[model samples]
Target: MTPPPPPNLLHDAFSADFEHELRFTRSVLDSSNPLLEDLLGWDEQGPRPGLIAVVDSGLHDATPGLSKAIEARFADPALPELRETIIVPGGETAKNDSNVVESVLSAIDLNRIDRRSLVAVFGGGAVIDAVGFAASTAHRGVRLVRFASTVLAQLDAAIGVKNGINRFGKKNFVGCFDVPVAVICDEAMLETLSDRDWRSGYSEAVKIACLKDAPFFDLIEKNADRIRERDIDASRPVIHRCAELHLHHITRGGDPFERAEARPLDFGHWAAHRLESITDFETTHGEAVSIGIALDTMYSHLAGRIERSQADRVVEVLRRLGLPVHHSALHGEAILNGIEEFREHLGGRLTITLLDDIGRPVDAHEVDPEVIARAADLLA
Candidate 1:
């Protein structure tokens, strides 16, 4: 009888649904606009949702009245009650340190922000990623609203369904996949960005265009100068299109949470992540991505996966956009180590995205280190 009991087996399976919305608007914190009220669903029944906002320290310094604006925006009875506003370090510095994440978590706890409450993160991609990590972990889960303040955040990082921070000298080593309650891209906030920061963001747009839309690539190529010069009119359409494409990939690409092995959207990210770490994040992510894209494009050419003309075109576009196609840090063991790190992150075989032509992406299970070395040399 004991032997028969040992033969018994149990199995179970379940599925959960996820749905969230994103908004592209201007001046989300402006008192006159009802975007915040609409996003929090204040018109509906229940108690007003508690809110805790975390602002980027750099941004706070740039915009002195930001706290007042935040207060005024939530002052309306129809909006969620503003509980506490915490300030955090901006840029990669925010992600490299664990204490940044802890501070946000501590703020969430001290504010008594529950799963029903909202954690509004206002800053560039790094700040959003760090704060989103905290919100996702606190109370097992908490809704996050991203007020994307930079071009990079609006078009790429804030639109992402995943959130993360770097650890162990690795990029995005600590993180989780959790969609935010909503993402708000405030176009007005982009005005205060430095020219360097403005140029830094378009690399992501180039990445998406290279992977999914040839026509979009042409548009970016055409407007590269205006965008680099802070021409908002030229930049706005590019931002909208890039954000749209990113959202489409997340919602329709059937791999929003990256359960699949191949990541088409990460066309140039393998070396990009490595470049950032090796440089101690002196190079911005978008800048590293630009160089990564150039490296991979040249690799694709050298490996006979794509025509050299196409690869040249990619490099040219990045250059025309005021983005770096090469960096001194690319020549190193650390950059090559990224392939294994990428494979570990993918959680199976090594799958990387390459291109046969603009907008035509293919997956490769293995890459030649010799070819990678040659490509880096060429970029150098």
Candidate 2:
């Protein structure tokens, strides 16, 4: 009777604000650059907060002087005190192994990386994702400064507010959304990438262009050769514009944390993620994404959402950039599971982004396996 007398329950809502910052420069570790120092300026925490450096092992191996650079940069009296420089596995290994996360957390605990202190992470997308996860979870959270060293990291992964590691054989299955203190993209780092890694990053550029900007797509299409050849002059614009477009979508698109159903930025990610898992990561994310874009573009054509010529153009661009357009795994039933898995990830009805035309993306409620088979056939 007392419960009945009570008028149901009280309901309320609250909101919080966050700031996301990104910078593009060369030699941020150089003594002349004030960007890193300014970002890490004195706060109530301390005049010189502790900083733990977690670097990608692959990057450390690839770039001969990189370890020396990190040591030199953090040794400066003006910046945060260098706690220790820890080298973790790079690429998918960083995200796949639980030990990577533990090692980072262990380092944080050992070094006492508090919320006010900093975890300056240097690596590609995977290492950043994993290290960021460890940093965010330690003592609730810690200030993180990302040195995005790879093309993919600079253009897409590092700038995002989300971070995570793979789990249960799923890509990014374990992760959280947390903004970093700063995301610094040093273009000089791209010069260290191999031919394959260099080519891998452009697929993301192609992906963003297809979803939101026709002119950007055209620009990428036009400069495919120079980009493939590792011409920084030709590639920098694509990387910058892609980063800007992604940042805009995350902020202005009104769903930075993906609390809703639709995920427009994931234009072809369903198939892409599936392909990566199915291939046991033999197919790189960028290459898998290239294949995903091709598969979905053709599906759009079959669904009458876009013209055949437009779909062909998407495939053509991916190929010109030296990315894969198809994988044998797409024909398997495992690939079909991504639709439901994706829906679960989003926590609602299926919402896949398909293109009505370049620069015009529409959410698809569901995908047909037969139609997907047809798309795969076309790619073949």
Candidate 3:
């Protein structure tokens, strides 16, 4: 018997005056050869486009050869002239730190950047978010590309065009919608990740599965360990499948720009942002998201939106992955206050993604404050 072909991946391209393209490919950067020639529509006959590759500083020492490879590949006179490569540290601290922004701005002057030039962000989710935010704001708007180097970045952050920066101790408080020209996902980079980093990204994979694909959820539960171990062969299909699910919802024309209304796509992010803001970004994004998912699940139960067993199941999966599903470190009152703050932050219009049934999401705009309080009690 032959194995079945992998599911056909689907992505909805949002039609705008600006072009946004998302692609997932293998071996993004190969042997000092820039893939941009084929990936970004470069030909020797045409004028060379300016390019900047932003990498994480943490990988500077570990992957010294990567930067040199990028420089050499882009330096080819036959191809586009690589303007300069900026390397910034990866992680929550790096995203919140303003110094990285300063360094990035210095490397590529906003006045010099235009639609012809491209900004390639090569790091984890935080790095991509920071770079995307910078590129969007630079000169009003410039073309951006994501060479996602981590699992989380490749599957989630790299696909979305939302760019944002932390402000006043808040997560992604300031930002805009500037989708990238393309996103390249290279599985090769996963080999160097530590176990913790691998698991951190796994939370996002699980989140996608829970929100959209129930079959994908089953796949994740069964292959959790293989993925955490960075088994690329076993994990590639899973990553591709999850990306498709996200693309399906995003392209459905349900406010991808996030201007008019909030949608179910932000299922667990409401509480997640508050946690990161309050903790001063001490918590990993994925870890904080796990906690947020649990809190929301509890709230769903209290609101009579979902069954108690469904809530418990969500908590169980998070726990098995070694993610924090409860806020034991913080008091109940603090958690309740955080939720209230979250509500206020959104202008009191709580757009929550609740389970009408497992694998089915119902968007609720007005959730009772009493229900939120009762949910906090359960966590307490």
lDDT of 3 by residue, 58-127 (tens): 6555576998878876666655567787778788766688887777776668435566788877888888
Please, what are the lDDT tens digits per residue for candidate 1 over residues 77-169? 787789999899999988888999999999889888888889999999999999999999999889899999999999999999989999999
TM-score of 3: 0.86
Order the candidates by TM-score, highest first. 2, 1, 3
Error (Å) of candidate 2 at residue 53 is 0.5
- Each candidate's TM vs. the true structure? 0.96, 0.96, 0.86
Cα lDDT for residue 159, candidate 3: 79
lDDT of each: 0.89, 0.90, 0.72
Question: What's the number of clashes in each of the models?
Answer: 0, 0, 1
Candidate 1 segments exceeding 4 Å error: 1-13, 43-45
Clashing pairs for predicted structure model 2, backbone only: none
Per-residue lDDT tens digits for candidate 2, residues 1-380, read: 34557677898999888888999999888878888778876655556789989999988998888778878977877778888999999899999999999998999999988887899999999999999999888888988999999999999999899999998988999999999999999988888888888888888899999998999999999999898998889999999999999899887889999888888878889999988999899888889889989999999999989999988999999999999999998999999988888888888789999989988888889788999999999999
Clashing pairs in 3: 57-88
Candidate 3: global Cα-lDDT? 0.72
